[model samples]
Target: LSLHPVSVLVLKVNEVSLGIEVRGEDLAVALQAEELSLQQLGTVGLWQFLHGQCSDISFQESSALKTDHIRPAVGLRFEAGPGAAVHSPLATQNGFLHFLLRGCDLELFTSVLNGLGPFLEDEEIPVVVPMKIELLHSRITLKDDIPPIYPTSPGPVPITLAMEHVVLKRSDDGVFHIGAPAQDRPSAEVPKSEKRQSAKEQMFLVPTEEAFGQLVKELPTLQKELRETKQALADANQEKDRLLQEIRKYNPLFE
Candidate 1:
């Protein structure tokens, strides 16, 4: 995959504290055509929108902190690549698959920071302080395979796969759970009366009865105005056609 231009909001490194922080914004990644072997995936291409923030990266003394962990908020998306779905367990009805991630928090632990002790003698590497991360909302969509148009044309490609979104939320117990794709209770558990009331409450928004009555009263007038506008447009078109015909009679080039 080829990397596109990357832009960051802020980048800071503290030599005294032996810490580094990077806050990125509007970062993009892309894969050009024929960059990878297409024998298995067939003319694959990819574009990524990294619109999430990564903040609060610092190194601290291992003993001062409890455990070394990194959790970051993330918003990332991948687009138009069959290679992305190679490891997916789910099957797509169409030939393409789209992936979307929103509102996610990821946490992981590692000892790589502490292993850097030999590089920096004066500064102590932290073995316990967790890395903090934040990600924003993003989506990836797949388009229909249109050879010759892709990797050349600058126009937008048409999407083929249905977009599926997943949201991660931390519960009160501090464990992350899938908030979307909510489970439905058994139909037998809900009474018919309650179901009817719920349906009534879910009605779409509409004009108030008084406002609707007013509109009804002026319906004839509105219809008359619409007809007048259409007539005027027709008259203008006729006039334009007459003028063009006259020009064609005089100018052989126009004819």
Candidate 2:
């Protein structure tokens, strides 16, 4: 009965340079992406691209990426200011956190959600979606039941966490938001994936009218190419059949 949409992204020292970890969780937890860079896209977006493969200039820069960088940790519960709309002139920057939750204490994680009840409450439904946390200078303690993949002491250790969510457009203004608002969703238009990418990120655009016309004009050429290919295949098959017939004729068994 507690099914919620949750997306997590992991950015580790070396194990995971960049990748998306798609998972379904009963508890809805949204972690804000920091720096809002294209690197975050590799893990959040339905369509994924490698760090350097994307058009992000930072990815292209040799010194931009570093695995040893110790990411900031955030609290289990926190507050977020109203984010600027994508189309808003006042929209400048929002420092977000990226978190990864794996092999951790589920009960403890659930307990942490206790503080987020107010923020997660949805007016349209009975379910609650937790407010996105910004883990800054805090460590997440794991349960003893889960085996430790990374080196850890007898107690808790710090880990990276990344967040993904549907981009919501404010009805009042066209600006996009990271977390869902209490307002009705239908009025918000169809939500889009809110994976932050760099300005240099590339996307496949729909063809223009002129481009479509050109493609229509080239249909005859394409059909001609197809016809020529079929003909060549037919000619090759005929040659093969003739060669086989000649071989059978020359056989002593025929004589």
TM-score of 1: 0.21
lDDT string for model 2 (1-255, tens) is: 123322222232222222222223211123221222112222222232332333342321111232221221111211123322332222222222223222121112322333357567777753222222221222233223333577654645534333222223322233324544223255445334233321111111123356558768988997999899999999999999888788888883642
Give the whole-model CA lDDT for all candidates, comma-separated: 0.32, 0.33
Regions more than 4 Å wrong, model 2? 1-211, 252-255
What shift in Å separates residue 253 of candidate 2 from its native position after superposition? Answer: 6.3
Per-residue C-alpha lDDT of model 1 across residues 1-255, encoded as one tens digit per residue? 335422222212111111111224211122111111101121222233243333334432212112111111111222122322221212111111112222222121212223244446656542221111112232223333334556767655643322244434332233454433322446675445325321211111123365458768888997999899999999999999999999988995984
State TM-scores per candidate: 0.21, 0.24
Question: Candidate 2: worst 10 consecutive residues by lDDT?
Answer: 197-206
Give the per-residue Cα lDDT of candidate 2 at 103: 18
